[model samples]
Target: MDNPVGMDNKPIARTNFGSNFKIIPTNDQIKELQTVIRDRSTSRSDFVFNADRLIRLVVEEGLNSLPYGDMDIITPTGETYNGLKFLKGNCGVSIVRSGEAMEQGLRDCCRSIRIGKILIQSDEDTHEARVLYAKFPEDIADRKVLLMYPIMSTGNTVIKAIKVLKDHHVKESNIILLNLFCTPSAVSMVTKAFPLMIVHTTEVHPVAPNHFGQKYFGTD
Candidate 1:
């Protein structure tokens, strides 16, 4: 199949990040919003609010990477207007707990989209990601999947989740990972392993606010 069509604006691919690793272009507004969430002194309410704003942006960018088909529709003026339809079905799979935080943003765009869950935890000793629970749509194999895992640090958890998707017959090329914050090292690691998969993130930094789940959920 042809590679998933990236955004018309195109995803920025820095030479160091390699191809298929798309960074959402950021501006002053995004920078300030990110700063609010990243600041340790920020209140939980502000953190969650600003975080959702960034997540929404990342979600929109991820949708742009999916394939679409052109269709002309008659407008109110009785004129044919060109429109586009998604090429195939899409379902979301969120890494349990943390990834669930992004579900609302995805739902905002896809009101009735199906979403699945995978629970993975890192072993304290080896620090390797282990999948404990997973539940997916019966027809996940036929749908384009948006894997929602906000913060990608070591990339171990994402790689583990991708393995599960592959076992379920989801094509590597058909999956789009909707992420908000990621470290450059983590991006490099994930891309090296799954070159065909698409990853859309707002920014790539050396360090990520891994406590995002706790802050967003008021657990911190």
Candidate 2:
């Protein structure tokens, strides 16, 4: 896939993050993303519906980043077919309310995949993120993890979440961050902090608007 071009007219690959990041490359995916962004100006229901569609695209892209193994399957016609299967041990970890929005998309893509939750909130004054609660599959350390968070603006929350995963013995390389939108600052911070981690997103905005979640949830 070709590198995503940022609003500044530069390739996303020039951000110094190396190959640890991927942006949805298809025109159809980009078109859907634009539709979701536009729906933000309409009713909440419209925004949610479109947002879910975009999330599904990103989740599917994230799943593609996971390791897969080859297998032989018997088709209905009794013919041998070679197929690829996701590694056995895998799970999804949502970063909380906003992240939970992507759970359905994850489930739709990976049937019966285990899900974990981590609640983190940023301090109003300090802007630092703190984990309020976290739950993960007991075998998460051995499973490839998809860390779900719709927006990565400051990256502090993602950093904290990764720390929590590390505390649980989940290797950095095994974690894939699935996001819908992000800023260059956020990408820089995340990739610098965790070079081995992979970040998959539908778009990278030059600047992350403060009202994204509020607008989507109709609280703005």
Candidate 3:
């Protein structure tokens, strides 16, 4: 918990938070599978597989940070082809426990990438987010950071975690939240707290699959 920045990244933004929110497009099949994860009758094996499949899309999009420009290459025909280049100084920081579940999908997207961890828990008395541990790349300030947490409920944990990053000199614009499902309240609170921050997710429902970590890790 070195240099924890108390709470919050900056003054809440007065602008609309919706513009900063990005949702992964879903079709009928994707929609049906999303429902599968929330069904209590689903078994652990099924739950883990389907959940992984769905979030894999989100993970890829967030990691790729898509639709690049400026780089061009030549094919065998000698014709120029425009393409995207993966930016250097990119790293991921996952909030421990539940957030750890999204780690593998991230690795799959970037094989040699470095990953960081931050462990935040709620104080029993104060009911506030408390950072117990944090570790990041030495040059994290220069790197684009992805906060890999699946679900956002009250958003207290995420707000606190972002503060920790800001303390270490990570710019709000350089940070992207990779989430699977979040409520409108969670989305609004987080986007307002750090307006420049970007959020990528699959769905924004009234209820998140909060049981995600428990079931994904087989704790249930």
Candidate 4:
């Protein structure tokens, strides 16, 4: 497969990870992100609102990749109908702080869905991500997991999170990454490390913002 052209007009690497790697095809999503990034005057509330909207789309795209089974149903007209039903037993696990931003979107998509959290921060000196904390459901091994992380820069944090999931017995093929933006390098690194995993995102950027979380949260 040919690499897709990103905003910088550079070729973004394509992954052999699986059929689940998806980029939401929506100009509106791009527009919203541009508004959030280019408008330095954008208030924190407004930025969060636009970001959440985009996150909802990413979450929906991720959920669509989950396993589904066809079933026969009866409609209001008492006619037999054929429909596809999502397989039950799915869960969301988010890398804390930035990743938590996508959790509400997941809940909106699937009410009462089980959610887990992992806190992984980068070491200031080494710049490597290390898991500080993790909390997951006991039956996580049996459920399909949607790993939420808003940005994929070096792919270090995400890789660590995936390792934690694997340690908890989550199957590699059953894990899907829901991200807002990802760099080509990050995408390649992640797919190469876990070829069976899926990655779903709104856009692919050539580079990540220097202080994405800080800027968005008005902490910078």
What TM-score does prediction 4 earn?
0.89
TM-score of each: 0.91, 0.90, 0.86, 0.89
Residue 28 CA displacement from its true place in model 4, Å:
4.4
Compose the digit string of candidate 4's lDDT tens values, residues 1-220.
2345677677665655356567777586566675685477877787777777888878888888889999999998999998998898899999988888788899998998999999998987786998899999899999999999988888899999999999999999989899887787888788889988888876667766545577666787
Per-residue C-alpha lDDT of model 3 across residues 1-220, encoded as one tens digit per residue: 0110112423333235556677776678667777899899999999989988877788887865632447899999999998877857888899988888888888888888899999999876775999999999999999999898989977889999999999999999899999888776788789889988888877666677889989999998
List the global CA lDDT of all models.
Answer: 0.86, 0.85, 0.82, 0.82
How far out, in Å, is residue 90 in model 3? 0.7
Per-residue CA lDDT of model 2 for 1-220, tens digit only, reads 6565577757766467668887778587577665566553567777777788888889988988889999999999999999998779999999987888889999998889999999999998887999999999998999999999998888999999999999999999999999988888888889999999999987666766455577666777
List where candidate 3 sits over 4 angstroms from the true fold. Answer: 1-15, 64-69, 76-80, 124-126
Model 1 lDDT-worst window of ten: 1-10
Superposition error at 174 for model 1 (Å)? 0.7
Which residue pairs in candidate 2 have backbone atoms (N, alpha carbon, C) closer than 3 angstroms, thus clashing?
Answer: none
Q: Candidate 3's error at 163, in angstroms?
A: 0.4
Off by over 4 Å in 4: 1-7, 13-20, 26-29, 215-218
Q: Which candidate do you rate higher for TM-score, 2 or 3?
A: 2
RMSD value for candidate 3: 7.7
lDDT of candidate 2 at residue 103, scale 0 to 100:
91
- What TM-score number comes out for model 3? 0.86
Clashing pairs in 4: none
